[model samples]
Target chain A: MNVVDLIKSYGSKTVVKEVSFTVPKGKVLSLIGPNGAGKSTVMGMISRLIARDAGVIDFEGQDLTKWKSKELAKHLAILTQHNNVQMKLTVRELVAFGRFPYSGSRLTPEDNEMVDKAIAYMELQEYQDQYIDELSGGQRQRAYIAMVIAQDTEYVLLDEPTNNLDIYHATNLMRIARRLCDELGKTVILVLHEINYAAFYSDYICAFKNGRIAKFGPVEEVITKETLSEIYKVDFEIMNIGGKPLTIYY
Target chain B: MNRAKMHRRNVTRLALLAVMVLVAVVFYLLVNSHPEKPKLFQYILSLRLPTLLCMIIACISIGAATLIFQSIVNNRIVTPALLGMNSIYSFLHTAAVFVLGTGSTLFLNANLAFAVDLLTMGVVGTLIYWYLFKKTGHNVLYIMLIGTVLSSLFGSVQSAMIRVMDPNEYDALLGSLVADFNNINGEIILFATIMLLVLAFVLRRELGLLDVITMGRNQAINLGVDYDNVIRKLLFGVVLCMAVATATIGPVSFLGLIVANMSRQIFKTYKHSHLMVGASLMGMLALIGGQMISQHLFHFTVPVSTFVTIAGGIYFLYLLLFKKGAY
Candidate 1:
């Protein structure tokens, strides 16, 4: 659960330079940064979506790079920025895709159990049979999340999970992300633009600035007014509401 | 959207395929009895069997391959031809005739020339997949534009070569490309049939993979499917199938589009296995039906391709006008 010195460069330019951090098991790590700060790039490298120029990721004291893709997929799942599926699959069918890592294409009895559990976990049982395109943005997002949850991976990486979601669904998504770690004991690593959501829900924050990790610590240490102002280049006031830190930046 | 629905569609498709194969078999029997240059039945047999085989080969393979290509590209408008595969094939043919003289076009080693055509088309097909998909990361439009330009350039070069050829060879060259199935050699038909079967066997593993591929890259990769490998293999498979179809019966313009669109409407599922199996049957049905009517009903020796154009043309127009059809 520790990443040792990860670096990613994009052809004569380093999009994610020499970044390193660690995520303990059963904890949430939110990556926050301004646009084009390589937050997504780091997530891509960790999830093997984008190749790293130089890095070593030691998860459970094993080199992540050396792990077989199938094995890695079984332990980790990623929901990317755009889920432009080519098929008009139903929510249940889409969720079933998450089980592909456990077995090959054929879903096993165990896979079925996980798929059903994920569907229930996401509160999507009502819309399970509905076509994904026919669903509202929030419902579709939940379905996509359900698919990742069905992967049953130890860690789940999501990029801009709230892109098209309204506040109600966005908050629902953050709450579910926290519940995955607290109740299910899964590490949730996310790249999100919503600083307040990150501050409120995250146990730890890993802020990236210019392809580098600016700070990596508990939420209390990372979401301070000065740190928020530096990372986002915007003035912010940290207000604690119901004992949870909220960074109000306008 | 419905599991039962997909299964039902599959069953219906299988039944239709069975019926088409039975009809094709009956027609094959009828055509076999006719002889090469003799009385009505004998003359009919010689002409019809080749025509039957050629139509069957082009229709089924082109339809199936085009459906697969469209699935992988995630665009309904794209066909194997849009990849400039036919251009690579026809260009090679034109070049062979230009340099080797029209005599070389009919070389003693027909197998060698066929192999050359297949290999060249295969390479071009692979390159098209590699360049647009893997190398440049370009979209479908860029790929199509590049392919269209290349095809036009090759077509012009081919035409220029044809213009300069001696009038006597020109007649022979033009005649060869005209695709009168009666002129088909048994050996060529046999070769094409075997190739199709072999391709089917090889692509069996990829049939399911195509379904996941349409889900796009992130989901495919997250599911531990090697997206790049599967795409390359499938695209290559389409090229092989397309080359066989074209080399066997010249280019049947837009046959893939016709079959794919028809199958999508009928099946309503995005699985490649279903689409391919369904389209292959639809293609054979189209070909076989066209042949039967042309021989027994129309009473004219019209090419099967011509009949397909009428059907395909109408379907194409419907698809264009139907806004929801884009999905």
Candidate 2:
């Protein structure tokens, strides 16, 4: 995926401006920034959820806008931060919605296999028959991710996938995200508020400050004290946790 | 969908359909049972046919329209009546009576006035919603907000006109405003049936999309449904159905909400096909059953609207209080 000079504005306020980045195949790219830093906006633009004012997004050697939405769903999928649905759906039913673009909500054997595999991957097999609203915050988040996994696209973009998750589930989500890239060979992009999770799990970290990329590089390069303090405007201390650089901003 | 679960839901729906048909039969015979006139069969056909037809059309249109509207808006509590069709109808009726003194030919000729109501409200009401949907960028909340304001505006204007109007005219206006099964126009029923048929045909394939839509806008888009186009079309369909029912039957605002909620509660699935049929049957039952009660027990002294309003209002409160799940 390649994006150049991507721009989005609401009325007069430009939320995302001239953002540029590229993600290679089979890599995890983490977009990390504070609130109102435009990370989610950039993620939304790439997924085609939010329209862009001016930009060129190239996916798999074709312009993103040139692809039909249904055709695009075969190559890309997204899970927004808020996954609240008013319908009473089981986890299985919710996962089946992921196959809508392919089979139009009809479950062939292949679609059924994919749904089951996704549920297992997310460790949600025990809760497959449970209602989504009845699940805990972490479980619901996992179910949503499982749905995205069931979409089985080459490119998966998630905005704040770990928003309401506790620490253990949040870490598990990061591990699953990594496995999706390393094991399945899919390109993944995520907007994460937890800097440590991004620093630990992502191959590339694109930190944002004020609607623009402050730093974009390999994890080792972007997690430095200088960059972290500059991007977040906070006093930062770096510590090696499990031989990986983790930042502390308290 | 598990096999056993699907079978159970189907059986429940079938039972609902059976009840609707039975009630319809009773309603037909009940209305014509006591006629003491020559050419009794003709009296039954001519007199009761239009009322039955009107009830059926109102049931289908209002039931399906409300469910679809709730799906698109993602709110079970709000109905198409929130779009102010009733208020618009009231305002138009009051304005007519206020200006023409209720003795004009427009008031005397029921068919002409009914046509005028259907045409003006159909065209103008749909236009109002269409324009608002475009302006709000298909935001249901904003459309609903502006709709409430417009309804309030229409209500005030109607009340202001009613205040100065002659008492006799006010009495006539009140009768026209409340939904009455006996006051339907045959021509309007014919028009509504044709529209309903066309709508059903057009929506055959798209009805499946409602399950995805119930997931919410982003998921629908992710599922490759054209979120904007499909929603716009659905909104247009809802507006058309609502315009016909409100213009013809004078607006039973709560019938849709009542039946739709019941359908959702009973079906417990997201598929629109089942919900549409289930809600339609439930709506027919409500109208026919309520008509039976009002006509027989109350001797037609109580309006059908009174029964529906009280029952629907009570159910609405129940949903609000106990059913805290999503729409």
Candidate 3:
């Protein structure tokens, strides 16, 4: 997927301006930036969750806007932050909703098989019957991810998937994102606040600063202290951990 | 719980509610018929049947409307009554009597009045929802707030009109203001039933997406449900149902709130197909039981809405205080 010259403005304030990037297939790309840097806005625009004022997004050599929403949903799935499900839904019921794009409320045998696989993938088998509201934060996040997985889309977009999760669960989620690309050959995009997780788990990192791309390259090229300090407006020291660059900012 | 077990449980609960409705219907139909006076028994049955049909239609419409409205707004505490549809109904009747002197064709002709009321309410309600949603970018809270404000605005205007009007005109207007099961016209009931059937036919396809809508706007859109279009269609259906039921049998404010919540609590499921059915059954049971009690126990001294309002008010309080997070 390639996005060229994207622009979005809320009233008088332009949140995203002249942003451009290309996503490699079957690889993980993380959008990392400080608050108000337009990473999420870019993500939202890319997934068509938020309308763009001006842009051209080429998905498989076709304009993204030309793709029908239902047909596009078959190839791409997105999980936004703050998924507060108000209804009383079981884990199984929630995951089954992932098959809605295919079966639409009536889960065929194949849809059920995909739901089962997603449930097992998320390791939520024991809690499949448990109500979502009764689960812990991390478990509920996993259930949502499982739903996205069950969508069986080749391109997955996760906006701040690690929000409100503990470090252990956050790391676990990162590993799952890695496996989603490495094992399943799905292209994944993420909006992340933790730069280290982006460096360690993602193959490419796009850093946003003030609604424009500060740097976009491989992890090794973009995870340097100079680029981190320049983008975040803070001093940064870098250390190698597990053969990946980790940032220590002050 | 396993899926099969949950399915069985929901079915059993629905069956139990159905049986309760049946018992209420039978008791309502046969309890006071005098066997000694056969002619009187037949006359009473004839009188009672239309009222039964009106109550059934009103309850089903209110129940289904409330459930669907709640799902679209993604809120369990609200009902279509909050949209000021009932207030509009009362306001229209009061205005008609006040301006037209209670002798106009719109005031005296039940069928014509029913058509006018339904049309006015449906159009006005749809306009309010459509305009506000467009202006506010589909914010449910803004629509609800505007609805509450409009309700009070109409209520103030109606009461002001009622106070200065002739006592005879006020008396004529009183029947349409409060819900009265005994005085509904047979023709109006038939009209409402036909309108309801049309609405049911139009909304059958959209009703299938109610479960997806319960997941909220973003998820529904992500699942390719065409959130805005579906909401528009469903909200229009809600307006029609509310208008038809209110115009046919007057406005029963709290019945929808009571029945919809009770169904959700009992079924404990997100699928609106089950929720709508459960709510309709519970609504039928409530209306039938309330009418029976008003006839037999209270000897027609108390109106059925009195029972529903008081019970529903107390239940609303219980839901607010005790069942805060359960919904």
Pick by DockQ: which candidate is best?
Answer: 3
In model 1, state the lDDT of residue A199: 87
Residue by residue across A49-95, what tens digits does model 1's lDDT show? Answer: 77677778776668876777777888899998787665567888889
lDDT of 1 by residue, B1-327 (tens): 467776786787779776877777586557546545458776766666676677778777897789878877778877877667787777777677677776663543666666766777778768756677765563878778877887788888888888888998778666554444445434467777887888788877776677777787777777777767778888888888888887777776767888787777777666666777778777777767766777667665786668777777776777667835355
Give Cα-based local distance difference scores for all models: 0.78, 0.82, 0.87
Residue pairs with backbone overlap in model 2: none
What DockQ does candidate 3 have relative to the true complex? 0.68
Which ranges of candidate 2 are over 4 A from the true structure? Answer: B1-3, B30-38, B89-127, B130-143, B157-179, B325-327
Off by over 4 Å in 1: A1-5, A9-12, A59-65, B24-39, B99-106, B164-172, B178-186, B294-302, B310-314, B324-326
Write model 2 residue lDDT over B1-327, tens digit each, in one string.
Answer: 563677586777768686767767576565646556657767666766677678878888898889888888788888888778678867876777788776888877666676566566656776787788668766778988998999999999999988888888888877766556767645567667887798778976667788888887778887777777777677667876876677566689799999888887888777787788888888877787777777678878897888889888898889888886554
Task: Determine which window of 10 residues in candidate 1 chain B has minimal summed lDDT.
Answer: B178-187
Best by lDDT, which number?
3
lDDT of 3 by residue, B161-191 (tens): 9899989888877866565677765678778
- lDDT per residue for candidate 3 within A119-151, as digits (tens), equals 999999999999999999999999999999999
Model 1 / residue B122 / CA error / Å: 1.2
Superposed by TM-score, candidate 2 places the C-alpha of residue B218 at a distance from the truth, in angstroms, of 1.0
Worst lDDT 10-window in candidate 3 chain B: B176-185
